[model samples]
Target: MKWFKKYHLELLLVLPMTFYILGFTLLPLIRTIILGFQNRYTGKFSLSTYQALFARPDFLKSISNTFVIALLSLSIQIVIAFIIALVLKQRFHGRSIIRAIVLMPMGIPTIVSGIIALYVFGTSGYFNELLFKLHLITKPINWLTGNFKGLLIIALADMWKVLPTLVLLLLAGLDSISQDIYEAAELDGANSWQSFRFITLPLLKPTITMAVLLRAVDVFRIFELPQVLVGKSVPFVSTFAYEEYDIGDLNGSGAASTILLLMILVFAILWLKFVDRGGSFGNDS
Candidate 1:
C-alpha cells in the first residue's frame, strides 16, 4: 500500500491507456470468444462454426497463404529497409527530403494504396501502357485478377507501404549508436565491414527485433490491401471472415476472427520470447 502511494502519480499517467485497452481490446476480445463458440445461426451453442471453417476446401489454403504473405512481406521489407536505412544514415545531399519521400506512403491510407495499385497495375493501366510504349508486351498482363498474382500484388502493396516506417525504425536504431564507437573501431584498424559486423549490427538487434514484430503483427490483421485489391471472396483469412459476415454468418465470422487473433497472439508470444532471449527488449545496455 505504501509503495502504491509513492507511485500514485506515475500510475495516474497510465489510467487513460488502461481504460482504452480495456474498452477497445479486452471487452471485444471477451465478446468475440463468447460469440465464436455460439451457434448464432440457430441461436444456440456448438463447435459447428469452427467445423464449418475447417470443412471448406480453401480454408487450409487461406491459413497457409496468410503465413506466406506475412513472412515474405516481413523479410523483404526488413532487408530492403535495412539497406536503405544504412545508406541514408550516412551524410548526403537532400537526405531529409528523401527520408520524407520514403515515409510518404505510410501517410496515405491503406485503401488509397490499393486504389493507387489498381491504377498502376490494373489491366490497361499506366504500367502496361509504359511497357507497351517500350515494346515490352503485346498485351497488358492482368496483375490483379488471379489468385497467385493477386496475392503478389497485395504483398507488394503492403511492402511498399510498410518499407518507409521500417526504414525510419532502423534509422533511429542507427542513430542511437555513438560515433565514437565507429572511430574507436577505426583506430583498431577495423574496416567498414568489420565495424558494421562487430558494432552496428549487434547494437541494432533490439530495434530490428522490435520492427519485425510490429510489422508481423500489422501484416496479420491487414484487410484493406488484400480486400480492395484481391476482392472479398479470395482465400485470405480476413476476406473469408468478410464473406461469412456478408452472408449473415456472424458466429462463423467470429470464429474465423478468433482464429486470426489466436494466430497473431501466438506469433507475438514467440517474438517476445526470442527478443527476451537476445535481451533485445530489456533496459540493460
Candidate 2:
C-alpha cells in the first residue's frame, strides 16, 4: 500500500495496460474452457467431445504432425534468426539494403508466400526442373507430399514468412547490449566465439525467452501455410479446429482448441521452469 502510494504515478500508467490484457485474455479463455466441455449437438457438459476427438487416427496424426513441424521450425527459426541478427549487427556498407532484404519476406502476404512456396517446391516446379536438367535425378520428386517432406516444405515456407519478425526482435536485443563488454572481453584474450558465448547469449536470454513464447503460441495455432500447402492431408491444430467448426461441430472444435491451449500451456510451463532454474542470465550490469 505504501509502495503504491509512493509510486502512484507509475501505477496509474501501468493499470490501464494491466486491465487491457486481462479483459482481452481472461474472458475469452473462460468462454473457451466452458465451450470445450459441452456437446456440439446438446448444451450438456461432458467429456465425449474429447473422447471423440482422440478416437480419430487422422486427428491424432494431425496433432503429432503439428507438434513435429512446430518444434523443428522453432528450433530452426531461432538458430537462423540469431545468425542473421549477428550478421546484421556487423558494420558494413549497404547494411540497410541487406537489412531490407532480410525483412522483405515479412512484407509479402502469407497467402502469396504460400502460393509461391507451392510452385517453388512443386513436382514440376523449379526445384525439380533444375535438378532434372542437371541430371541429378531421374524424375521430379513430390516435395510437398509425404509427412516428412510436407513438414519440411511447410517449415521452410514458415521460416521465410516469420523469420524476419523474430530476427528484428533479436536484433533489438543485440542493439541494446553495450559494445564495451565485448571490447573488454577481447582485451582479455577472448576470441569471437568465446565473447559471443560469454557476453551475447547470456545477455540475450530474455529476448530469446520472449521470442520462444510468442513463436510457440503462434505456431501452435498455425493454419494457413499447412491449409494451403498440404490441405486436409496435413492437419495442424488450427486447421483441424477450423474444419470441425466449419462442419458445425462446435464442441469438437472447442475440444481441439483446448488441446492447443494445453500444448501452449505445457510449453510455457516447461520453458518458465528452465528459465527459473537458470536464474537471471540477462542482467547486463
Candidate 3:
C-alpha cells in the first residue's frame, strides 16, 4: 500500500499512454494477424490467403517495386539532405531564409505533393511543355508511363516531399557535435575531408541509422503518391493491400499487411545489427 501510494503519480502519468497503445496499436495489429491466418469464408485457421497472395504476379512485382523505389528515394534524399545539413551547419548570409525554403515541403500534404508531381510531370505538364517550347522535343513526353520511368518519377516526388525532414534530423545531429572536436582535429593537421570522414560521419551514424530506418518503413508502406499519381498502373505493397481491401478481400489484405509488417521488422532488425557491428550508437569511442 505504501509503495503503491509512493508510485501512484508516476503510474497515473503512464497509464493513459499504455492504454492507448493497447487499445489502438496492439489490438489492431493482433486483429490483423488473426485475420491473416484465418480462412475468409469459413473463419477457420488456414494459410490459403497467404498462398494466394504469393501466387499473384502483381503482388510479387509490387514487392520488388517497393524495394526499388525505397532504395532510389532514400539514396537521393540522404545524399541531398547530408549536403544541405553540412552547408546549413556553417554560418552564411540568408541561411535562415534558405533553411525555411528547404523545410517548406514538409508543410505540404502528401496528396498535394502527388498532385504537384502530376502537374509537373504529366503528359501535358510543365516539364513536357518546357521541353517542347525549347525545341528539345517535337511532342510532350509522357513522364509517368512505363514501369521504371513511372517508379523513378514517384521516387523523385517522394524525395522532394521527405528530404526536408531528413535534413532537419541531420542538422540536429550535427549540432550535437562539438566545435572543440573540429578544432582539435585541425590542431592534429587533419584536413576538412579527413575530419568529416573520421569524426563527423562516425558520430552521426546513429542519427543516420534512425532516419533511414524510419524512412525505409514509410517507403515500404508507400501508397498515397503512387495511388494518386498512377493508381493501379504502379502497384506497391500498400497499394496492393488497398486494392485487396477495396475488392472486399479482407483476409487477403490482412495477409499482405502482415507480410509488409514483417518485412519492415526484418529490415529494421538487419539494419540495427549492421550498425551495431560497424560501431556502437552515437559514440564509436
Candidate 4:
C-alpha cells in the first residue's frame, strides 16, 4: 500500500496498458486454450483434434519449414540492416537522403510488397524477360514451383519488408553509442575496424538482440507473403492454420494455433535467455 502510493503516478500510466493486455491478449489466450481442447462441431471436450493435426506428415513439414524460413529471413534482414546502418553512420553529404531511402521500404504495405514480389518472380515476370533478353535462359523459370524457390520468394519478400525496420533499429542502436569512445580509440591509434570491433559491436549487442527477437517472431507469424506467393496448398505453418480454419476444422485450427503459441513461448524464453546473457556480458565489462 505504501509502495503503491509512492509509485501512484507510474501506476496510473501503466494501468491502461495492463487493462488492454488483459482484455485482448489474456482473454483471447484463455478462450483459445479452452476452445482448442473441445470439439468445435459438438462443443465437447476431446483430444482428437490435436491427434488429427499431428497425424499428417505435412503438418510436421510445415513446422520445420516455418523455423527454417524464419531463421533465414531474420538472419538476412539483420545482416543487411546492420551493414546499411554502419555505412550510413559515417558523416557525408546526402547522408540524410540515403537514410530516408533506406526507410522507404517500411512505408510500403506488406501486402503490396507481396504483390510486387509475385509479379516480379512470376513465370512471365520481369526477371525472366531480363534473363531471356540477355539470352541467359531460353524459357521463363517457374520460380514458385519447387520447395526451395517458393520458400526463397517468401523469405525474400519478408526480408524486403523487414529490412527497413531492422535498419531503423540498428541506426538507433548505433546512435546510442558514445562518440567519446570512438575518439579515445582514435587517440590510441585504433583504426575504424578496430573501433567497431571493440566499441560498437559490444554496445550494440542489446539492441541487436532486441531487433533479432522482434524480427524472428514477426517472420514466424508471417502469413500474407507466403500465402499470397505460394498459396495455402504449400506446407507452411501459417498457411496450414489458415487452411484448417477455412475448411471449418475449428478445433484442429485451434489446436494448431495452440501449438504455435507454445512455439512462440519457447522462442520467447530463448530470446530472454539470450538477452540476459548479453546483458551479463555488458555487465562483466
Candidate 5:
C-alpha cells in the first residue's frame, strides 16, 4: 500500500500522456501506412496505388521540388540563423531589445506570415515598387509567376517565421559552452574564426542536431505558406497530398504522406547517426 501510494502520482502523470500518444499519434501513423498499402476501391492489399503514384510525372516533379526547396532553404536558414546567434551572444548595448525584436516573428502564425509575404512580394507590393522607383526594372516584375521565384518567396517567408526559434535554440547551445574553453583557445593564439571552428561548432553538435532535426521535419512538411501564397501553382508534396485527399483519393494521399514521412525519417536517422559517431554529446572541443 505504501509503494502504491508512492508511485501512484508518477503513474497518474505518465499514463494520460502515454494513452494520448497511442490513441492520437501512433495509431494515426499505423492507419496511414495501412491506408497507403490498400487498393483504392477494392479495399485489398496491393502495390498498384504506389505504382500509380510514381507513374505520374507531376508527382515526380513535386518530389524533386520538395527536395530542392527543403535542402536549399534549410542550408540558407541555418547559416544565417547561426551567424545571427553568434552576434547575439556577444555582449553589447541593447542586445536584449534587439533579440526581442528579432524574435517577434515567433508570435506570427504561418498563415499570417503568408499574408505578410503577399503584401510585401505581390506585383503591387513594396518590392516591386522599390525596384521600379530605383529604376532597376521597367515595370513591376512578376515574382511569383516563375517556379523558382515562387519557391524562393515561400522559402523566404518560412525562414522569416522560423529563424527566430532556430536562433534561440542555437543560442542555448552557445550558452552551454564553457567560456573557459574559449579563453584557453585564445591563450593558444586562436583568432575568431579559428576559435569558433575549433571550440564552438564541435561543442554545439548535439544542439545543432536537435534544432536542425526539429526544423527540417516541420519545414519539409510545409503547406500553409505555399497554399496561402501561391495555391496549387506551387508543386510541393504537401500541397499535392492535399489535392489528392480533397479529390476523395484517401489512399493516394496516404501514399504521398508515407513518402514524405519516409524522407523525413531517413534524414533524421542519418543526422542522429552522424551526431552519435562524433563522440559523446557532453564532450567539449
Candidate 6:
C-alpha cells in the first residue's frame, strides 16, 4: 500500500498508454500472426495459405515493386531533403516563408497528392501539354506506361508528398549541431566540403539512420499513390494484401501481411546492425 501510494501519480500517467498499446497495437499484431497460420475455412493450422500466396506470380512482382518504389523514393527524398535542410539552416531574407512553402506538401492529404500527380503526368496532363506547346513533341508522351517509367513516376510522386517531413527531421538534426564547431573548423582553414564531409556527416549519422529507417518502413507499405496513379498495374506488398482482402481471400491476405511484417522487421534489424558496426569503426578510428 505504501509503495502504491508513493508511485501512484507515475502509475496513473503510464497505465493508460500501456493499456492503449495492449488493446490497439499488441492485440492486433497477435491476431494477425495467428490468422496467418490458420486455415480460413476450418480455422485449423495450415501452410496452404502461404503456399498459395507465394505461388502467385503477381505476389512476387509486388515484392519487387515494393523494393523498387522504396529505394527510388527514399533515395530521392534523402538527397533532396538533405540539400534543402542545409539551405534552410542558413539565415537569409524570407527564410521563414521559404521554409513554410517547403513544408506545405506535408500537410496535403495523400489522396489529394495522388490526384495532383495524375493531373501532371496523365495522358492529357500538364507535362505533355507543355511539351506539345513548346513543339518538343508532336504526340503526347505516355509517362506512366512501362514498368520502369510507371514506377519512377509513382516514386517521384511519393517523394513530393513525403520530402517535407524528411527535411524537417534533417533540419532538426542540423539545428542540434553547434555553430561553434563550424566556426572552429573555418578558423583552422578547413574548406566547406572538408568540414561537411568530416564534421557534419559524422555527427549527423544517427539522425540520418533514424530518418532513413522510418522512411524506409513507411515506403515499404506504400499503397495510395500507386493505387491512384496506376492501380494494381503496379503492385506493392500493401496493395497486394489489400487485393487479397478485397477478393475475400482472408488467409492469403494474412499471409501477405505476415510476410510484409517480417520483411520490415528484418530490414530494421539489419539497419541497426550496420549502424552499430559503423559506430564501432568510427570509435576505432
Q: Candidate 3 clash total?
A: 0
Global lDDT for candidate 6? 0.88
What lDDT tens digits, residue by residue, belong to model 5 across residues 1-285?
999899999989999999999999999988888999999999999998899999998788789878888887888889999999999999999999999998999999999999999999998998999988899988887777778999899889999999999999999999999999999999999998998998998888788777877888987899999899888777788999999999999999999999999988988777767655644433545
Give the poorly placed runs of model 1, Cα more than 4 Å off: 1-17, 41-44, 133-135, 187-191, 274-276, 282-285
What are the lDDT scores of the predictions, listed in order? 0.85, 0.88, 0.91, 0.84, 0.89, 0.88
Candidate number of the best lDDT: 3
| Stretches of model 2 off by over 4 angstroms after superposition | 1-28, 133-135, 275-285
Which candidate's TM-score is highest?
A: 3
- Using all chains and alpha carbons, the TM-scores for the candidates as numbered come to 0.88, 0.86, 0.92, 0.87, 0.92, 0.91
Candidate 1 — number of clashing residue pairs? 0
Q: What are the per-residue Cα lDDT tens digits for candidate 4 across 147-185?
A: 788888888889888788888889999998989999999
Spell out the clash pairs found in candidate 4: none
lDDT of 3 at 42: 99
Off by over 4 Å in 6: 1-3, 132-136, 276-285
Deviation of model 6 at 187, angstroms: 3.0
Q: Write the per-residue lDDT of candidate 3 for residues 33-62, one digit (tens) a residue.
A: 899999999999999999998999999998
Q: RMSD, each candidate, Å?
A: 2.6, 3.4, 2.3, 3.0, 2.6, 3.0
TM-score of 6: 0.91
lDDT of 2 by residue, 1-285 (tens): 999799999989999999988889887777787888987777899988889999999889988987898798899999999999999999999999999999999899888889999999998898898898899998889998898999999888888898899999999999999999989999999999998898999888888988988898877878889989999888888899999989988788888888888988998788878764443333435
Clashes of each: 0, 0, 0, 0, 0, 0
